[model samples]
Structure formats: C-alpha cells, structure tokens
Target: MQTADALQLLLTPDDDAEPVLIDGLSIGAAARADTTDRKKDVTLEHFWDETGDPDDLEEQRWGVIAPEGAAGDRLIALIQPLIDARREAQGGHEVMIDRVPSAMSPEEAARWRKQHFDVSVELARDLPRYQLILGDLNEVPLALQQHQATDGFVGRLCFREERAYEAYVDKVLRWERARAEAAGGARFFTVHDRTAATTIGYRSLVQPAVAQLGRYKLDVADLGDQDEPSPDAFLEAVKRREPTVLFSISHGAGAPRGGWKTEGDQRDRQGAMSFGRDKLSGGDLGDAPFLPGGIWFMLACYGAGTPDVSAYWHWLERLKQSGHFGGQTQSVLAGLPQGDQRPFIARLPQTVLANPNGPLAVMGHVDLAWTYSFQERDTGRAMSRPSKFVEVVRATLETSRVGSSFRELLKASIVTNVELTSLYDDAERLGATPDPARLGHLWMLRQDLSGYVLLGDPAVRLPAMRRRLKKDAASAGEPGVRVHEVRAQAPLPAVGPAVAAERQAEDAPKLPPDMDIDDVERAIGKLLSGSPIKAVASEHDIEPKQLSALKEIYRKAGRAALGVK
Candidate 1:
C-alpha cells in the first residue's frame, strides 16, 4: 500500500501544494472509515424545505443577543441605533434584544445553552425566530451562537468602535430604503487550480450551484484563474459593487510555513485570503467600498473567525496517536489552535462589516475549512454534496433575508447529527466496537456543517428592485425579467401553549443552578452505588427527577452534552 504522502502526490498536480483533503486530514485518517451506506444516502436536500410562510413578516421575529450584565449592556448601548432601526423595521412585531448568561469559553457557552435553549421542556418561547448576536467570540462565544443557529436564523456583529456601529446602521437603513443597482447579479470568483480546496469547490460546488441558479435568470459572472489571481483584480471587482451576492473560493491564510512573527500578527492575518502572492486583510480593505449592499459567501478556512479551539483538535490527536502522517499531523495541528491565544472574529470580515459601504452579511467557515464540507468519500465513492451551499445561494437570489439563507446552510448539521446519533446507538446496542472510519466521516460532516456561521444582522436581505424601475423596464418591453416570488414553506408542527407548561410540571427537574457535568456524574455514580435517592437529591440540591434526567443524558449522549469535559 502506498504511503499517505505518496497517495497525495499521485492525486495532487502541484508537488509544492498539499491536497486539501490531506491538509484537512491525512489519507490514512481518511482510510479509517469507508463504505457507510447510511451516510451516503443522507443528503441535505431532504431538509432544505423551510418552515413557516416566507411572506409572513410576523413569522420573522428578530432579536439581538449579547453577553449578560455590564459588558453586554455596554455593547448593546453601542449598537442601540442598529437595534432601534431593526425594531422600527419590524413595525408591529415585537423585537427583543437580550443578553445571554456570561460565557467566555465554549464549555461555558455549552453550559448556558443547556440551561436555556437545550432544556427538554421550554417554559417560554419569547425570543424571535431570527437572532443577531452582538459581540465577538470572546464576549458571547461561538459555541452558543452555533447551537442557537441549528434551528434558527443567527448572525453576529463585532466592532471595536461605536462609530463603526453607527456607520453600519446608517448603511443598512440607506440600503433598505433604496434598491441596490443590479441586485440580481451573483458573481463567482475563484483562484482556480491553486489548491485542492479551491479547485474542487469551483468545479464541484460552484459550477453546479451556478447552473442551478440559471433557472432563476440571475446574471452570473464566473471569474478568477491563475492568470487573473491578483488581489488588485479582486479588489476592482468589489469596487464595482454591482453584484448583490459574491462567492469566492481560496485558501484562508493559515500559520505560515515558518510560523507567525507575533501573536498579534496571527490574530490579524490568520483568516486573510491569499490572491497570488498578495494577501487580502481588513487593513488592506481600510474602510473601502466592498460588496456594498450585498452579501458574501467566502469559502475559505477561518473566513468567518477562529474558535477558541478547533473542533477537530481531539480527532486529529487521535489520528496522530494511531502512528501515521507524523509531520502532516503537526502541520495541521499548528493551525488547530489550542489555549495559546484568544479566539476572534476574522479581521477582514470585521473591517468590511463596520464599513459604511460593505456587505450586509458574510457566510463563511469559522474554523479550519476543508473539502470534506462539499465532497464526501466515506461511502467508498467520491460524491458531491453541494446542496447546503446551493441552498444559501438559492435563498438569497429568491430575496430571502440573509439570516434565513444562513439557516438554510446550517440545516445540514441536523441531518449529520441524526445520522451520527444513529451510528452511536447501533454500536451501543450490539455491544460492538464502533467503526472508527464511520465515526470519523460523520464527525467531519457535523463539524464542517457546524463551522459555517453568519457575521452581520440576520434581518438584512438583498434589497428589492424599485417598483418604478421595474415598471419602466416593463414599458420598454424588457423580456425575461425575473420577478421575486415568495414560496410557501411547510409550517412547523403546531404546539399547544399549555403543553410545555404541563410537561415541565411533570418531567422537568429543577437542576441545581450551574451544575457541571462532572459533578452530575459523581452524583449519578453515588446513586448507582446504592445511595439513598432522598440523600442524593438533598446532597445535590436537585429534584429526584433531575437526577433521572441527568442519568438519561449520560446514557444517551454522554457527559460531554451536560457541561465540562
């Protein structure tokens, strides 16, 4: 059998550049799992149907979430103008902007999510369907945001200055009041053949998605290749600002071959995109007009931001322990940031978002992006899974709000998680070893889908072309002009208002406030060891039902779901 490096050499055209699949994980790691027919059949299209009527403004409630207490209060005050504008836009609909429990890390975020959103019995559903987070990864934490986004529309805005927020709100209001020029045009830019990630993304995902978009009659521009892969050309395209949607495929700047000169340098440049030899950073943008009144889907690693830690950290460590791709593992590990530094929203996105002339929202990967997101090979055959990517483009082109479009992309995580759970259950039931390869594939799928997030207000959408403009064009006998249509979404199953209250009265246990998972497990262990129920309940200050619930959680999803790992 060929070595992993040798296989990569066989597949990749450029010897100097590693294949994205290899960069993401070694061939040996990929070889661990194969021919999972279950995962192969799972497709994103099955969950593409949106719930609730698209035309109903009432169905689209909007809210802003931030950190709890002083920090959140200050941040909210800074962005109050934007919040007020959004609330006014909602008209009669109630818009509540609230703060989440204080959480500075993913684990803390998980705890807060469990206490609120993940409860088995939801007592109140007061918040809106669309939520815009109001801080960076440090303030609110990406884990909490990602969890909320699983079934709801979510976006984030992080700015260092109050003036930036003021500028952004003014920009949003201006754009909302008037239609953007050539709003129906969608542009695709790619540094083609540069790396495996870019090459496959353009050919497999971008091409197919564009072909699908042709049915909507949106003007499409496909540009970027070795000859035209300069930052100047890309900047010029953005300066034109004609397209309401811009899609690009390239490498997000990672740790250099020699490593970053300083931690500050890494924070600023880690997520920048390389155009030939030139790099595009927020500093490079410098308050310039970039995708004004538009949306951007940047397909690159850390294009959105870096998490406090990579979700794949543990999995990569496991692969490394398996004794293959020693050097390759370290190369990837260098990018899988641990506790060495603080997580941050990418500088490029932050700068553009705060600009007066900038995109309304950006959809991109928050962690190390890989070809695993769009291409699957675990079923023993290479298959393209571009529906998630296509769904975002399709929704945006159809005049859906950027938040709703982002939710469409995230729906794949639900599909992937369900399959992952099923795989876990089967292994447990049969008392058989779980297939490592199958687990790896499902894990990657879930992480890849979960990594995508929105950076901006969820309420923002591509502006509708003015009615007068449309009428004038019609009088000129403009043929084949595409009109935006509001397609019906299947309504979510109706829930009785009293049903949740009743369920909470019965099954909902009053868990001790902010109890960590390890503590819960210790209590469970004592109970299993034949300790008195009343004694355990009293000792933990939790209801007996709470203990039962915690045990079930442990049995099913393990302690990780509860809190600290």
Candidate 2:
C-alpha cells in the first residue's frame, strides 16, 4: 500500500526480478508449451475466452486467459479495478500496472495492443494511477500499430508470451485483494460504486511476514556470450558474497559419452555435440566456487544428475562436500525445459524473497513438459499461476513454526519427492524396473511422512523393504543401506628419523623406567591418527585414559588427530 510496501514487494528472491506469474499464467508451462503444441496455449486460450468477464465479476478473483478476442479485455477489467481498489485502501497510494506480452501472431498482436490501450484508458479515466507496460509485444503488426499510435510504445513492451502476462496479473491482483479484505470498513468493491469505486488496482500478493526475508536477483552468465563472465569469475563473485538463494539458468550436460542421455541426443545431425567431450558431461562446474551457506536452485539439467561410476563424485556432490552449502545445497529443481528458464528465472527471486524465511521447498520437472502435470494436485486453481508454487512454499515454511535444520531437511524431502516423481516417469518410459533397494532407502530418508501416501503404488512397500535392508546390514556388520562411511584421508604430520626411532622404541615392549613419556605420547599420537583410541588401547593392553592423555600431548604439539571436526 505504502511506497515502501510496493518497493519491498518489488524486491524478489531470485536475480532475474521477473514475475513468476504473468497475466495469471504459469511461465514454466507456457515456456514448455511454446516448444510444442502442448496444453499451455490451449488451456490459456480456453481460460481467457471461456472464463467470466473481469469487469462483470464481483468476487475478488484471478484466472488465466488467451491473448485473443475479448479475453484481454476481461483481464484488463479484472486487474485494473483491483489495482485501483488497492490504492484507495492504502490511503491514495498509487498502484502500478506492469504488463508483459503473451502473444506473437499478427492478429493476436493487434488484439493485445488494443487490450493494453483500452486498459490504460480505463485506468486513466476511472482511477488516479500509474501503469508500466513491460516485456515484448511479439506480434510485429501490433508493435507497428502501437508505435504509430504513441511514440516509444514499442520500446516499452517485451515479447514474452501469455504465460508471463497472466502470472504477473495474478500476483498483483492477489496482493491487492488481500489488502482490500484486510481493510474492510469502506469496501473497495461494492454494487453501488459504478465509475470511480468500480475499478480495483494492484494488490500485494506477498504475505507481510514473508516479505521481510532477504531478497536477491539471480543473473546467470550467458555461456554463449563472448564477454560473459567466466566460470572462475562467477565463482569469485559467489565467494565474495553469498545470497540466501542462488538460481542458475545456464546450460547443463548429462553424463559422459558412454552414459545414457536423459533428454535427447546431444550430438547434432552431423554427430557433433556442443561441448567437445562425449556423452552428457557438464561444463566446468567443478572449477566454480560454491556458496557454502546458501540454497542453490539449479535450472541446469544434470547438475544434480547422478554420475556413471558407482563411487565417483558428480559436480553437485562435490559442491555439497565443499562446505559452501548444506546437504540440501546439492539439491535442485531440475528436469525443467531449457526454454522455461527465463520465466522461472524471472519469478523465482520474488517467490523466495517474498517468504519470511528462504523458500522451504523447491519444485521442478525432471524433464520438460508443455503441460504442468505437477499442477494436477491443485485442481481448479489457475494452472498457469506462479503463486501456486509460492503458496506451497509458504505453507511448508509455516509448518516449521519458524525455522530449523529439520525444516530445511523437510524442504529437501519435498524437492526430492518431485525429482523422484520425474525420475519415476522417466524410468517408466525407459522400461527400467524400479530399484526397490534405492527406492526403499530414499523412502526412509524422506522427512515428510505424507510423501509415503503419494507413492501411489502399494505394491512397493518401501518401509518393509527398508526393514529387510537393515537386517542385511546388521548381519553383514556394516553400515545400513542408507548410510555411507567415507574414510578421511590427509597426510600424516612429518616426523624426524630420530623422533620416529624414539617413537618406535617407545612402541617396543620396554619397562616403565626406560619409556620416555613424551615419546610414548608421540607414538600414541601417530597411532591415534590412523585408528580409533578405543581400538588401539584395547589391542595394546593400555588404559584408554593413558592413551587419551598421551594423544592430547601430541595434539598440543600441532599433530593431526582424527575424530569428528
């Protein structure tokens, strides 16, 4: 409502600062659909034409629409009034209408241009407000026409599709609707108020509490740009300062030449891949420095994809091990279509920044899809909206009652569930039998118990399988299936020949009178560095305390000691 409030809402969590939801459409789905004649275009058109008129509608509402025909008029009618109402409710605070383009056809283009002018006139004639038209008008005819009508109009528009348009509308309207409801004495929307009070303006969709979280913008280095920042430069930037969230929209490769290609054949028609190496190897992520204390939203494919070898490490794994990020840092909302990165990149920052804490959950496709199958979970809700994901994250974060390591872990679980679903779909297509061992272990690690309910198939009792796994582990006298024991490796401290010989002498069975206490300590230190003190003391028939005290002396001398850091 206030200038400060508007400014705060404008600051998003991601770097792109683009709206996640535009004109009530989900950018991710729209981008995916743009690649193919998928549900994005069809659904958008249906919603726009079939849905009720925004001007005639009374309830505080939001919906998606096609850019053609009367759909744009309905959206304009619906959104402009909400914006006006928000301004009035906020004590004459001016509302801003930011329009993003959603169509490219000449006919559709003209329609969009007309819609904008009509909406602008409505705003000017009805309410005291300001509007900012952003994004490209893809249709050349409309651009030319609009340019002829008003100077600089072409420059003000961006050619982004309808998905972005609808998403922005939804966010703005929802925010304003919430504000209007909160301030109730003089209703912003009433049957009697026809002209001045009839219009509703932009509302702040971001929750007041959640809006306080730190915001950031995620601008990925363009790999194709000759002047673009190198991986090292990017790493250095990250090392100097870390954001609460990192959203990367760079290109990614899968495994090496011999490994399976998850998306498509990387090789061109001439059998040449973009990168020099064979298979699905990624660009030089290993060389990049990671932000230790932040969450990474990898928009790249295979950034978290598993490696080919059994024990070999992947880039995500290495990043996780580098101590720059938590266990969840390696986690990603992957499998998104390459084209959809722009919309995701634009909206993610705002969604994350709008939350009181960092995003408690991140959801992404394992593979690109024109239709967002994930949204089936929330039926009747606007499928194209960005606020859907925002709502899920908000609810998840609130369940924590604040924040905790467990909550972060829960966030990881939800992200993993989404990834697993995508993987399940992929595996089904590839005809790979679901590995019960892997599935069981993953189920055990899941922090959200409700996830088990979503497993859908009762045939695979993950809990029972995990129990069997535990029994096998106990019988084999090894760590359980889900646990991995990594032996620590580092060079031993250098000791002189005389010191080593003294240590050997101390180690040799000798009477107490000949034993040098310092030499005994050095020998104990060297032994403890490699083996546990309990094992060493028990094997050599010495008190654990004596072994501990001796080891402490060497530790004081700057020698290496092994244990948890």
Candidate 3:
C-alpha cells in the first residue's frame, strides 16, 4: 500500500481529500441499513408543485410556493431573487429527490413521475435544491441539511413563524442591497464565554478561529475574554455594534426533561450562548432588536433546533455496534414517536431570525457543540482543523447551490472517522495493533459533524463588495484592530481568507474604573510635565505611545476648555 494511504488507515483518520461513496449515501450511512423506500413513488416535484403550468422542467424548477402564514408569505418574497437566479440556470442534469424503482425491482407501482429523473451518485453543489417543511420543530426533519440526505437535498432554509420569517428574510434582502451600494465593512463578531468546562477551549481554538476570520479582512471583533466586565456590558456591546457576521462560542442553554418542549424553555435555552454561567436568550433581546440584519454563526449546543431521529439513528447504531452507547443515545438521538424523533421546540436561531431586526441567517450546532469542529488533537497538541464553518461560508457566498456544503464536508469528516473505528474494532478482534488516535478522533468528529446546522436560508447571498477607498499600504493595517479581506478572492478565493497572525493571549488591559478622556488627560499632563516619557508611562501603567496620545488629547482639551478658538 502507498505510505500516505497506509498512514490514513492508521493515524490521519480522514479521507485524503477524495470523496468516497458506498451506495449513493456516505459509507457510514450506507452501513446502517439498506434502502427501505420509506416514501413511495417519489417525484422531482415532491417539494414543489408543477400542476400550476410550466414550459420545460428547467423553467418549472423555480418553484414559487406560497405557504400560508405572514412569515411564510414574506419568506417567498425575500427568496424570489434566488428563485429567479435558479430559473435562469435551468439547464443540464439537475438534482431532485425521486425513486427509480427499476433499479430495485420492476414490480413497484408503474412510476408516476411524468418526467425522466436520473438519481446522481454525487453531491450536487449547484443543484437548485429546496424544501418548504411546514410544521413545528418536531414535525420537521432536522436532517434536512444532513450529508447522507444529500442525494437530492440540501438545507431546507426553514421558516417556523411567518412573522419572524418575513422580518428576517426582508432584512437579509435589504442588507444585501444596501451593502452592495454603500461603503461598509463586513464586520464579524465572535463572542466567547470562557467560564464553563464545555467551553474551556476558548484560548486553544475559539480565539484562534476568530483571528483567522479577522485575517479574512472581516472587521472581526472578539469579546470573550475571561475578565469580561459583566453580562450587561457584553450584551450592550453587541447591541451597540452592528456587525455583518456574528460568531459565538460558548455553552448554549438547554432543556432538561421537564421543560423540553415548553415555549419558555425553547425561547430561553435552545439558542442562547453562555455569558459565563448564564446566557442571553433570544427573548432577552426583546421586541426591538439592536442587530441590524446579517449572518450569525453560533457554536453552542442546540443553537439550531434538534434534528429528527433519522439524522442520528444510524450514527447511534454505529456507536452501539462499536460497543458504545447510552449517553450518546440520550443526548444526540433523542426523538419522539409523533415528531419522527426531532426536538419539540424551535431554537434560538428561530427567534434570532424571526426578529424584524435580527440576523439574515444563523449556522450552529443542532445538538451538542464540540471543539472538533474547530480543533483536532495532533501528537499531543491541539491543532486548528480547517474549519467546517469556513467551508459553509464559502459555499454560501460563492456557490449558488441549494443545500449546505457545510453539512457535506462535515459528513466526509465523520465518515472517515467512523470508518477508522470500524477498522479498530476489526483489529481488536484480529489482535492487530490498534491506533488509539483514530478512535479518539472518531468520537470528537462524529458529534461535531452531525450536530451543526445552518438556520435561515442557505441560499441567502452575502452582500457584494462595495467599492471602498483604499488606504495607502503603509496605513492599510488598522492599529490594534486587525481585519483581513473575507470576500472570496479575486480577494480570498472560494475557501476562507488567508491565515491570520497567531494571536497570543495577554493579560486584560488594566484601565481606570471610571474611563473619562478628561481624567486620563489630567493624569498624563501631571506625569509628563514633571517626568520623562518612561516615568510617565510607568506611573500610568501604560505604554509610552499611550501616554503620548493621552498628553496630546489633554492639551487639545485644554485649548477647547479655554475657548482658544
């Protein structure tokens, strides 16, 4: 065997950038069971209606479904731009969910699908895929974005309530339009809470990912240091700044057994990112939101709603097969008979997107959040993995595809990990030396891959780059504030932006309690007038430049106060 291929079988625990399919579905999905034909006589139009009239299947592919509801009605209008784009690209082999009974047996009901549909064995990045799943959170299939279901599917871009749905969708459309014509930074805000065990990796992974995004020329703001002033202060910061992208890493509030399906529980727990031990739930934002429409990627447990049982049943079984079970079942595979095993309440993303002033979209963990999505263990060191979230953003901004490329990449990562465990199980039986790294990596990768979900529309396009006045190269680098270009190159490419400078965590800045410019200036004036620059800096416990700036500002204040103008 080739050394690289052999190394992967034992240690790397990832497919060498090549996609592997077992039976149209991923190898892990295929291993669970045979195709059962759950729904009978499927067609290209299951998600759309063709009876209204059409020219060709291509033209007809642009489904304009009017699902009834104030929010649903608004969703259609907001996504009309995407629909029109799809209608324009209506040629070549398209993807649709349908059954080819001929492949299985000749006796199945004489196939009612009027048009010929070929089931492609590949995950389509550009297929105009969509599903308008109406009903409660439990009624819908959370795996609507799962990789195994990528046969003819992608993210459903679900709308739970017509009101919030309309509000967010319209907000997205307006943000895109306004951004394209105006000069503005695509600011991305990442808030982290470092106090919990679930979030101990703040320094290791979360902060690094934030820096990486900043290098993408996204005006990135990271607000999750250990000495955070207060929850109110953090919340106030979020309200004060209008960023284009918001990414958070922390503990999400969750429902215990009693409150699992309650409205209050759903509103408070499912999407709220931790503020130390507490959280700021969607309801906390109140009716008038300070967020002015943009994308939000929240890395907390159940930031998106839990998926239907179908998403994780096979995965659970695989774990059980490999001699692991119980907790994984209770946490990840929880389901109810009526809801196809999906969670019973709408998540924080639902509320965030539904707000008339909330985000355009949100991507988050549907169940448990994990460090594996951002970092991996390598030779005793925790290394930053190529972020799956970064891939999702690329697919989102660059490709006009229907489903999440986020789910697809994560699936590949999971399948590779799962395959290793199965290999280890076989090795244990055969007395072959087992690679422990593969098994360790497996558990980390599985929950991460299955749990992430993109809420709001997957088809929502980022704002086009507005023309900007370029600063001279010498002054281009914003001081202290580091922002790299995030727009796919020409500037960044289809992937994420260039790697950022590794940010070393330093002790929090010790500023005065009552921060007044005038007070700072007085201190600067008193120290500098009687002492050297170093002495002034030492007395203020600040840098020389900082003292100098303060002195300059204080002198300017003195002139203004004296009415020298």
For candidate 2, lDDT tens digit of each residue in 1-565? 2211110100001112121111212222111111111111110111122132111111111112223435445444544544454344323434433333453443464455456533454333232111223321221222222222221101111212444334434433333222111110000111111111001111121221122111211122212212332344434433422222333333233223233243343211111111112111222233232332233333222222211121112322443455422333111222222332221111222232122222212222111111121122122222222233233333222221111211222343444455546556677799885544344223322211111100000010001000000123333433322455689999677556545555654654443552345435534744654645544453233567876765655554333223212
On the 0 to 100 scale, the lDDT of residue 138 in model 3 is: 35
For model 3, the superposed segments whose C-alpha errors exceed 4 Å read 1-137, 148-153, 180-199, 214-218, 229-231, 240-243, 256-268, 287-290, 308-345, 378-381, 390-437, 466-565
Could you say which candidate leads in lDDT? 1
lDDT of each: 0.66, 0.27, 0.44
Rank list by TM-score = 1, 3, 2
Model 1 clash tally? Answer: 2
**Sorted on lDDT, highest at the top, how do the candidates line up?**
1, 3, 2
lDDT of 1 by residue, 322-341 (tens): 77545454455454455657
lDDT, residue 190, candidate 2: 12
Model 2 accuracy (lDDT, Cα): 0.27
The most accurate candidate by TM-score is 1
The true-versus-predicted C-alpha distance at residue 37 of model 3, in Å, is 20
